[model samples]
Target: MLEIIGVGVALIIAVFLVLAARQPDVCHIARSIFVAAPPERVFPLVDDLRAMNEWNPFAKQPSVRNVYSGPERGVGAADDFSGDAGSGSGRIEIVESIEPAKVALALRMDRPMKCSNRVEFTIAPQNGGSLVTWDMKGRQPFIGKLFSLVMKPEKMVGGAFERGLADLKTLVETAREEAAQ
Candidate 1:
């Protein structure tokens, strides 16, 4: 009876670990919104950390809070966020900028489960509109890899990214439309 109980407990733990290891190698989420205005106008709304609260999907939710630091509207700007277990806390810094051409940021976050990830956002001009891509890349720790056997990372986070992007597209485009009129 004792042997059976130990084996049962071990099997449960193994199942949980396997599930966590199968996450994605590169988790990417992007959405393009064509503003009647120029990239210069639309990009500013996204490039600024403080400005994001106005349209960010997470910002709309009550569980999250964002604090800004560093510069005001350009490179070196940073924002720290904390929320529910899933939301946790993280900081983002503007890493690169080329005026209306491109802007990029580095994202580092500490999630609830004690997992961490690195993320980046790249914005580029395309046909008078802007193409904004949100990407996250990180390696699973040894234990995380083992967990992946049961859970695929991409599958786990990809849906959230997709929804977030869709919401962003709507927010930016609507704001731009309002400004134009």
Candidate 2:
């Protein structure tokens, strides 16, 4: 009986390893929304880390703390988030900032796992408003690949992006309307 149990556990472990090995080396998640405001009107919200946290769903999560460093806003600006709950410890910094159109960031996770990722926010003029897209791309570490075997990483991570985008849409659109009035 003990031998059978050992074999079962071994088999499960073997299968998990095989599946994890088969997982993609890269992971990409993207979410987008349209705000009833021009790119210029919406640019500041994303370009500034402080303004972004106002609409960032992750920032609203309980137990997360953020420390600002480098610069107040724009390129070279960094935010080091430290905490044990929610998304864990990470450092996020703006790598590129293009006026009223695009902002790119580097995200480095320190705890729970270690991996470097890229985040991009793009604003484009469309349908009388701006089409905003947020994208994250990263190389999956071994643990991340293993975790993906039992979870859908895209849905798990993209859901936050979706919520953040919704909040951003509401904030920008409401501000736009108020400014017109």
Candidate 3:
């Protein structure tokens, strides 16, 4: 009886491991919003790390003390930040920059889950405003991928992205309104 129970437990463990290993090791999500401001105006805001708190919804205080390297706010520029556990410590390096169009960032985060990802912001001029798209992509370990499946990273993070975009629209639109007035 004891031998039979042991074999059953071992089988269950093996099956669970196999299933976990089969999960996708990569995931990505994107969210976008249109702002009643030109890409040129919005582009500069994204380039400046110090200004992120103004638009980043995930950041509660939105303010962070960071060590910076490279240019003030362009390709090769990087900033290091240590925040709360949920916020984590991380560095974002500007990997690509195309004026008023696209900027790609390499993000490395510590704590919570140690991972690196590619985050990009793209702006398209449209009818005196701009369409902005925020994209994120990362590859995870088998175990990490399995965990995300249960936790739903897209739903968790995507909601924040949506809010951030909405806030950005408000900020930019408000600035435009003030300028016009």
Candidate 4:
């Protein structure tokens, strides 16, 4: 009986390993929102690393500590942040920046998962407002692949991205209205 049970457990583990290995090497997810504000008003929020703190929904934890480095805005701009286990620690650097159009970021996540990802935000003029899209692409680690088998990474992270975009829309639109007065 014991031998049979051991063999069953081994089989399960082997299957999990195989599934993880079969998982895709690259992971990409994107979310977009329409903000009732122009590109000029939306560009600085993402271009200036420090200004990001105002609407960055992910690192809102009270324990998160952030240290900025390199240029304050545009390419080479970066920030390193550390916090509780959930928030973890990571570094984000702007690798590409085009005024009122796009900003690409290099993200290195160290604690929860050790991986490097390319994050980009693109802005497009639409109906007198701006359409902003956030995209994150990375190679999947073995551990991440294993976890992916249980829960998809896209679904897990999509909610945060959606909420962040919504928050950003509200913030910019509200400010635009107030400024018009």
RMSD of each: 3.6, 1.2, 2.5, 1.2
| Candidate 3 lDDT, 7-28, residue by residue in tens | 9999988887787788777779
- Pick by lDDT: which candidate is best? 2
lDDT of 4 by residue, 101-121 (tens): 999999999988798999999
Q: Considering only N, C-alpha and C atoms within 3 Å, which residue pairs clash in candidate 4?
A: none
Ten residues in a row with the worst lDDT in model 1? 26-35
TM-score of each: 0.71, 0.95, 0.86, 0.95
TM-score of candidate 1 versus the correct structure, residues matched by position:
0.71
Worst 10-residue stretch by lDDT in candidate 3? 57-66
Clash list (residue pairs), candidate 2: none
lDDT (10s digit) by residue, model 1, range 1-181: 9999999999998876666555554344444443444567666766777776666655556888888888887788888888886566777778876776566777676775445455555566777776766666665676556645655556666655566666666777787778779
Identify the runs in model 2 with alpha carbons over 4 angstroms from their true place: none
Between candidates 1 and 2, the TM-score winner? 2
Give residue 2's lDDT in candidate 3 (0 to 100): 100
Task: Residues 44-94, candidate 2: write the lDDT tens digits.
Answer: 999889889899887777777999888777999888997764678999999
Model 1 lDDT, residue 140, Cα: 62
Report the lDDT of model 2 for residue 99. 90
Model 1 CA deviation exceeding 4 Å by range: 1-5, 8-38, 114-116, 146-153
* Whole-model alpha-carbon lDDT for candidate 1: 0.66
